[model samples]
Target: MQAVITFRQFSFRYKNQSEPTLKNIHLEIARGEKIWIAGPSGSGKSTLAHCINGLIPFSYGGEMSGQLLLDGQDASGMTIFERSRRIGTILQNPDAQFVGQTVGEDVAFQLENEAAPYDVMKTAVSSALELVGMQAYEAQGPHELSGGQKQQVALAGVLSTQADILLFDEPLANLDPASGAKAMRLIDEIHRNQGKTVILIEHRVEDVLLEHIDRVVVMNEGEIAAIGTPDELLAAGILPRYGLRQPLYLEALSHAGLPLSGFTDLSHPESLKPTEDGSEPQGPPILSESQLRDRLEAWSTSVLPAGRGSLGEPLLELRGVSFAYEPGMNAVADVTLTVRSGETVALLGSNGAGKSTLSGLITGLHKPGSGEICLRGEVINGWSIRRRGEEIGYVMQHPHHMLTQHMVRDEIRIGLVARGVPEPEREQRTEEALQICGLYPYRNWPVSALSFGQKKRLSIAAILALQPKLMILDEPTAGQDYRHYTEFMEFINRLSGEGMAFLFITHDMHLALEYADRAAVMSEGRVIAEDAVARILADGGITSRANLRETSLARFARAQGLVSPSRFVEAFIAAEKKVKRA
Candidate 1:
């Protein structure tokens, strides 16, 4: 078989940097093979992906001392356009990759750039969209689509190029469980049907590309730590050593205290089955206060309530709130809600349902044109952004939009200083914030150098340093992996325990089911429904009202005939326990 990609003794140092981002790396990818490259943040996984696509020494200014061959040709001498014909790259940020207003235009942009004939481009674009299950969105504006839809469009655009090798950079990041599963399934189908060579860079490994991957390559600190089958890498126990989280199924098994012998060989289809005895020994409970806290904190800020109360005074209350950008535009309409002290409430809705706008009003980023916003039973209609920051910390949907500082440490300290914290005290608070966000190790690192997920954490860390009474996070886990999500939530739970309320906004139904206590569903800027998470999800009214699909886990549970909530939980726990024993 031809070697689709080959890297030998590859080392790359950025302009003016003393250390290389990728160091002494060696790798080989066979044609028609699907491989997953995984590691913790800042481990050079992205750099390696860039190397394979000829972006390192070609597009990016860097000192390259290595051999990179694409289709048996030296990659260093190829232009980006030349490389694109062989290796189509779907970037982590879908917005950054989009150049056309509509899905059809965007997918055809690349073909047109290559000067393909109109008929050829049209035919290729149609087929690519169909393959990715995005044919219905051909005329839809890319910006108007949901995050997941946009990602699918981006993938279709790449496929339209007819490249032999497809490179995915954290493609699942920011997607809800349902959308993530759909995207993964589409990729699997493409590889199986076309025998395409695929290179995936992602953190969620359990369900993504696991069954389809020919091999798994693990990177750590700018070098390859292990390269082998999924089973081989998992058994070696190198994941935790590199600050990466083990797969959830594996973790579940470990939590149940099951033996590793039964499930360590993940490649074997039989390994996923239950034991012959139909029962596994019970293990000690793995739940910890810290873990619980982390899980709760990780819930999107927009979902949380303003405070804890059985029926106490509302910290933030919206009475008959309604507004829109234009006269006929109704972003939010007749929204009436109250957030008490010490309660976590999640705002659940589809795209353009006014979740973000609702959050903006609560955070004082925008004022309601009608109705009243009350703080502790008092209206604060004209409060300044600074005053609102003192009471509520708002973390935006996009981390890049919120980031202004060049360094991670400085970003954290900026909030403290602005809050009138003394220089010495500000430094101490900044350090604490960094430690909480797991960015302490890279305190001095440039913000530009951080990954999409790390940048999200940094945005939260900066807001956390301010220590507001209510924190509103918009899509907090949008680009995060399972491990980071766990950690981030734990931190939030700790803060909630300290009497800080939160409002979480998100499109992730699984997240809402797992972490949220209270749920609020919105549609067309209206607070149509509100109830407990379980009740809201069970009703199916909210999903239909919001025009969203049921979460993947929920769908899978239903398919398996696990209707009862308790039964589903028991099965999940049992499956998790079974894996731990392997």
Candidate 2:
């Protein structure tokens, strides 16, 4: 196999940075191989990707050392345009990467830059859209697409260039499972059919590229930690130590107290089956109806209707809300919804369905010309932007948009100071927030130095410092992997228990199914239906209207004829316990 990307004792230090982000790293990626880079956040995974694509030393001013070769050429001497012609890079934020209004134009933007012929560019754009399964959306505006669709458009743009090596930085971030599966399939197809070299920088280790990955490369604190086959790495227990999840099937088996002797390969999906036909089942269901009901009741207790006789007071309400940036166009229309105290409601919808527009209206960032907004049982149509922030803390889909401070500690403290909190209490609260967000160690670190995941956590901490009654979080777990996702949600659950109401705007159906007390489906700028999570998901009308797909677990359960999907989580946990005992 020919080496496509090679880093020999490479080290890099950003401008004014005392320490190197990447230190004496040595790595080699062979041509036509699909590799997964997995590790804790701030582990130089993204830096490694940037180094390969000529962004590190060229675009980013940094002190560089050692040698880096891309396709047998020294990366140190290559211009960005020259490097880009050989490598296709899809960044973490697809929206930031998009350069054109329409999908077709965006895909063709790269080719046009290279001065490709009109016919050639057109054919490349068409083929790229087809490759990403977004051929039907070519005419749609980039802003009109959902988070997942935006990512796919960005991917199509990269593919249109026909670069031999594809570099993806958290490509699955903000995508729903179905779209994620599609993207993964496309990557696999590129590797198998096109024989392209691929490097995937991601945190999610379960199920995305497990079957297609040829090898695993783990990085920690700017250095390579370990590199090997998934089996070799998991058997050595290296993944969990760095907060990365092993394959769910493997983790589930371990949690279920199952013996590993019967399973030769933990990575194999078939390894999860019962080893013996007559083996005893796990102790009991993890979530009984009574338990689930109790949890639901507890959640609803704080926000239940104010009185049986009178319509409940709407903390925030929208009626006949319709909005679009231009005249004669509508992104959201006739949308009516309400959020009350102590309620955690999930906004569910497919790409381009206007959920984000609804969020902007509720937050007062965008006004609904056709409808009224009532806050605290009174119409707040006249409230200023500053006044809305006092009552509601809105966290955008991208944390960078909200972050304004140079240090994490300062970022958290700014909100407290603005809210008139006493200096002593503010300090105490800031410390507590940092501790909860697991950023205490990095309190004094520059905000720009933080990794994507850490920046997300810091954003949450900043919001927590304000202690707003209602928090609106958009795609809260967008780029997070299983471990971080679980940890972050656990924190949210704790806050919800403390009487904080949340309006969670998300595209992840699985997260909504697992965490939301009530699910509201949005379509064509309207709240088409609202019900319990299970009911909303099962309602064919709502599901179809929202363009929602069945969860991966649900699909797997149906394929295996399992009675309940929740049982799988419990069974897997039980298997893990059994394995630990053995």
Candidate 3:
């Protein structure tokens, strides 16, 4: 196979940094090969991607050496625009890259950049949009679209460029289960039909492996740790040590105490069947309800602290709230909800189901047209977003939007400084927040030098400095490596115990099941259901309707005729807790 991307002793160190983000790398990616790159948050995955896209030394000033070749040409000397024409990149934050107001214009912008004819651009845009199932949203503004929808539009824009090499950064970070599966299919189709080379930087390993990938390249702290085929790497348990996700199916099987030797492919649930060499049953064993229940109950008892205990008094309340950007098109409609002190509630729904809009309403970005929002029993409709922040804080999905300062310590100290706090108090709060977020060591580092995950931590630290009674964390775990994800959740759990209320808005069903005290589901701008997370996962009717999904363990339990969904979920969660979520 001809090499499309070649790295020879490549290394990069950002200005003012002590060490290189990428160090002494040597890698080769052949044409028409699809590879999934797995790594911890700051393990040089994104830095490597930047190298291929001509952003490292070009846009981000850095000390660089060695050589990176793309299509037999050196990538170092090429202009960003020239490299962009050959390598299309869909970044983690789709909104940041969108240049056009509407979907059609966004998709066509790439073609326009290429100076293609109007007719040719139009045809390419339509085909690209249709490929991503966003053809009907041609006139919708990117801001009006949901996070998942915006990501899809971004994918369409990249496709329109007709670049044979595509680089996707955390493509499924914001998508629901169904949308993510569809995206996998779309990318697979492009790889197969167009014969393009694809390099995907993703944390959702299990999901990406649904399509056929030629190899997996695992990175650890600026170095390649391992590279192998899916079966070889997964079966060898390569993900646990690196702060990455393991295949959900394998986790499910382990929880059930079943031997994994029977399975052929752990990546795809549909492909998970017994071996043909007469080793075990041809499929999942049917577990009885009582048997499954016992297993789950034992697991739960082992993992959960004596109990969820009594929840604290109500800290925040919403009464019949309705809001709209444009009259007669209500984005959040008549939804009444509450959050009690010492509770972490997972707010879940589809991409366009009004979760973000509801967050906006709660944060006072959009005033309610009908009902009232109360903080600690006081109506707060007149409060400004900043005024509300004194008692209520919000951390957005993308942390970059919340980060403005140049240094880590300064970023955390901004809120306290703006409130005219004494320097002593401000410094105290900043140090406390950084310590809680495990960012104390990086306090002196420039904010721009932090990786995406580190930036997210910085964002959280900024919010924590306020000491709000309640915090709404919107997809706080998106870009986190496993270590940070677990530690952050533990921190939240500790805070919840100390009487801080939390509303967790996220698409990760596993996170919801593992951490949420309760699951509040929204559908078409209404609170359709709210229940314990385990019960919510068990309720197929609600999950399917609202686009919330059952965990693989729950689904596996359902596959067994006698086992119940809730029972399997209990056992799975217990297993996770026993392992402290690996």
Top-TM-score candidate index:
3
For every candidate, C-alpha RMSD to the true structure in Å = 7.3, 7.1, 3.3
- lDDT, candidate 3, 334-435, per-residue tens: 999999999889999988889998999889888898999998899999999888978888999888889999889989888897889899999899998998
> Candidate 1: lDDT over CA atoms?
0.74
* Per-residue C-alpha lDDT of model 2 across residues 1-582, encoded as one tens digit per residue: 889989899999888878999999888999998899988877888888888887887777889899999878888888899889899999888887888988999999988888999999999999989987899999999987777778878878888888999999998777755566667877888779988898898875654544568888988889999998877777677888776866554543343344444344556553333333323565343444354334323322323221111223456777778898888788888878887666678998866678778888877888887888887877776777788888888888789999999988999999888889999999999998898777898999899877788888889889978888788888887666556676667677667766677888887665675566677887776788887665566455666667775544333333334455444533433343344336
Off by over 4 Å in 1: 133-140, 206-211, 229-242, 246-250, 263-271, 275-313, 325-329, 367-370, 382-386, 481-488, 507-515, 521-564, 567-582
Task: Tell me each candidate's TM-score.
Answer: 0.81, 0.81, 0.91
Largest lDDT belongs to which candidate?
3
Q: What would the per-residue lDDT of candidate 1 be over residues 311-415, giving only the tens digit for each residue?
A: 334678889988788888878898999877766689887767789888888777778889998888878878887787789889988898889999889999877
Best to worst by lDDT, what's the order?
Answer: 3, 2, 1
Stretches of candidate 2 off by over 4 Å are 100-105, 117-119, 133-141, 231-237, 247-251, 259-261, 264-340, 368-376, 379-382, 481-488, 526-545, 566-582
By TM-score, how accurate is candidate 3? 0.91
